[model samples]
Target: MFAEIKNIKSEKSDLRKFGITIGVILLVIAGFLFWKEKESFQIILAIGITLFIAGIVKPNILKP
Candidate 1:
């Protein structure tokens, strides 16, 4: 009963979704900067890694 009220207090507390999105966005921006630096190898590596992790991560954006 009380759990419902507590859940509404903070959406970020969702276990199914962590701070992965924020990290991904930041990684993308950083990757872009690195790419402009002529670091194509690392750009591919970072993008591949970010996509791989994002694909497996289950983000909870709703109250189930």
Candidate 2:
């Protein structure tokens, strides 16, 4: 029972970390787009690519 509880807690923690990482990435991208006066579609495409790459690289990011 305790092991299951610990696993649940760790999963939540990992999700929260991933959320934070993605949020920061988006914010930086938004700032750059604003600075450059770029199109909104470009921002969306950039974010999509960023997320795809992040998914591929997630294990390294999540490692302690």
Q: For candidate 1, write residues 1-64 as lDDT tens digits.
A: 6878665633534432334544466577767767678566466557645544543464343333
* lDDT of predicted model 1: 0.53
- The candidate that wins on TM-score is 2
Error of 2 at 63 (Å): 17
RMSD of 1: 8.0
| TM-score to native of every candidate shown | 0.35, 0.47
Give the worst 10-residue stretch by lDDT in candidate 1.
Answer: 9-18
Alpha carbon deviation, residue 12, candidate 2 (Å): 0.4
lDDT of 2 by residue, 1-64 (tens): 8667656533545655664567567767777777788877476557655654554455344432
Error of 2 at 17 (Å): 0.3
